[model samples]
Target: MKKARLWSLLEDGRVQCLVCERRCLIRPGAKGACGNYVNVGGELFHLGYGRLSALESRPIELKPLFHYWPNSTALTFSSYDCNFHCPWCQNYHLSFRMPDISQPVFSPEKLVELAVREGDEGLSASFNEPAVNFDFLVDVAEHASKRGLYFMLVTNGYFTEKALDALLRAGIDGWSISIKGCKGMQKPLGNIDFYVPFRNAKTIKERGGYVEIVYLVVTNTNDYEDCYRWIIEKHVTLLGVDTPLHINRYFPAYAWRKPPTPISKLLEIAEEAKKSGLRYVYIGNLHNPRYETTYCPKCGRPVIVRNNYRVVDWKLEKRDNEWKCKYCGYPVPIKGEYIPEKKWLGLM
Candidate 1:
């Protein structure tokens, strides 16, 4: 166990964790709602540090970040434990159980070396919650940025402002915040309820970082049109019309056994979001390639064509170090260098 860096002592020897939005206050020898942070002897420590539960090289598309670094592979790493225990969590095993810390330790330097050796375009902190392992992520992301490698975060966006501030300063390139439900849905796992999507979205955009919102449309739970409209009004409206919104179809996973979200419902919600002035919206977990590709909102031309997880064609014209469509003059929402290399193409 490692002493957590983002915590403080409270009155009467209690300890307060400032990692996620929960702001869990714990008494001596008690664990917070996350189950990984414990107040031992008046000091809070992160129990999951250095406990790597999962690591692999995956296509950037699996992260579902089509716009940021399309057609590239990323070295993804994750540790066990998450601040929120969503019933529909896909990776509940790692998120809820304590990770086997006996796995070989890889320092920030070693991780960067692996990413370069594998010809990876970037690094992703995913599979489980990365914010719970903030210490390692911050250090590794800083090193990756210096080497001109992209850094991505697939997070729940429950992080505190302080945690977000540290990551923004560390040069994270992209972040995808999952929006499960509004404030009125059934209580979140662990009985902890609090997620302000609008506030979090605003903060991420203000930092000049790439931000995407993922809303899991669970059947009969949060698939209402009103909730979809609320998300667009609160999160996407202020961020401009170009922000990417992913409407993922939810299936029975982890502890929940609900039926999969219907394709009709997904399309209905996507249509509603577009009418709300959202430029880019995509449907996930289905076999429709048309809904996955990105088009130029200005001219309605297909700028980036995607075949499942692979990017088939890119119609971007580079001038003055910016990407613009060749057909029209509309700007495409992509980042990083588009080097011409066959190795990166095969991994897409």
Candidate 2:
């Protein structure tokens, strides 16, 4: 356990955690909403620090981050407990429970070394809400940067501005935030302001960090056409049309037993987003080569071809220090260097 960096002591043996928007006011000998923060002697402690529930090296594309660092792998991990109570959380095994201190602790330095040993391009805090592990992530990001590795978050974007600013200062390179729309439908998840995610996305972009939006379209829930339109408008106007937006197909999980999102509906939303002037829109989860491929905005040709979660082909060439379409010379917004030696399935 470690003393929380983003917390304050309150009057009468209480403390307030300022890591996320919840700002849980915890009493002595009590735990906070996420179950990872505890108040001890009028001080807040992060019990989830260095404790991990899941860890693996996975394709960065699987994060649905199509725009930032294509054909790369990240050493991704997550801890237990989440501030939000989403009934259909896909990772409920981790998010719905209290942080298990019994879990093996991996120090920030050890994690960064593991990433290096695994030959990963970066480290990602994912699986469950990462705000609970803010201090740990900051430490890991610092260590990862020294080793020439990037650090990022796959989050719900419910962080306090102070926490976000701290993350940026810690060298966070990118964010793939889930923006679940429909305020009424989100009541199950504590009715968190749906606009906050959009606002945070804009903030990340303005701060010069790579960002991608992932909207999980649950069946009959926040699947309305207007939701897609609103998200498209925000993506186009706030983050710019070139920013990548992922329309993910949601399946039955946890308490929510609704059927999977219709593939046709996802395709329709993607088409509509394209027509709305968004350049990079994709359908995730239910994979098809057509929906996963990244097409050049200018030449209308596939710049990167992904089959499932693997990059099968890369058609962009580095010229003038920018990734440009080989045929049309249209500059693509992909960040990081292309690891040409990295073995790909169907390298073009």
Q: lDDT: which candidate is best?
A: 2
Question: Model 1 misses residue 148 by how many Å?
Answer: 1.6
Task: Please provide, for model 2 over 117-202, each residue's C-alpha lDDT reduced to its tens digit, 9 standing for 90 to 100.
Answer: 98889999999999888989888988888999988899989898898988988889789999877454544554577777778888
lDDT (CA) for every model shown? Answer: 0.80, 0.85
* lDDT of the structure predicted as candidate 2: 0.85
In model 2, which regions exceed 4 Å deviation?
183-186, 341-348
- Top candidate by TM-score: 2
Query: Which digits, one per residue and each the tens of the lDDT, describe model 1 over residues 1-348?
Result: 778878889889999999888899999998887677889999988776666777788877777887787788789988887877777889998888765546565688988898999888889999888878887788888899999899999988888888888888888868887887765666443343435545666788887888888888988777776667777676655667788888999989898898999899998999888988888899988867798898888889888877757777788888777788889887887777653432434422
Query: How many clashes show up per model?
Result: 0, 0
Candidates' RMSD to native = 2.3, 2.6
Candidate 1: clashing residue pairs, number: 0
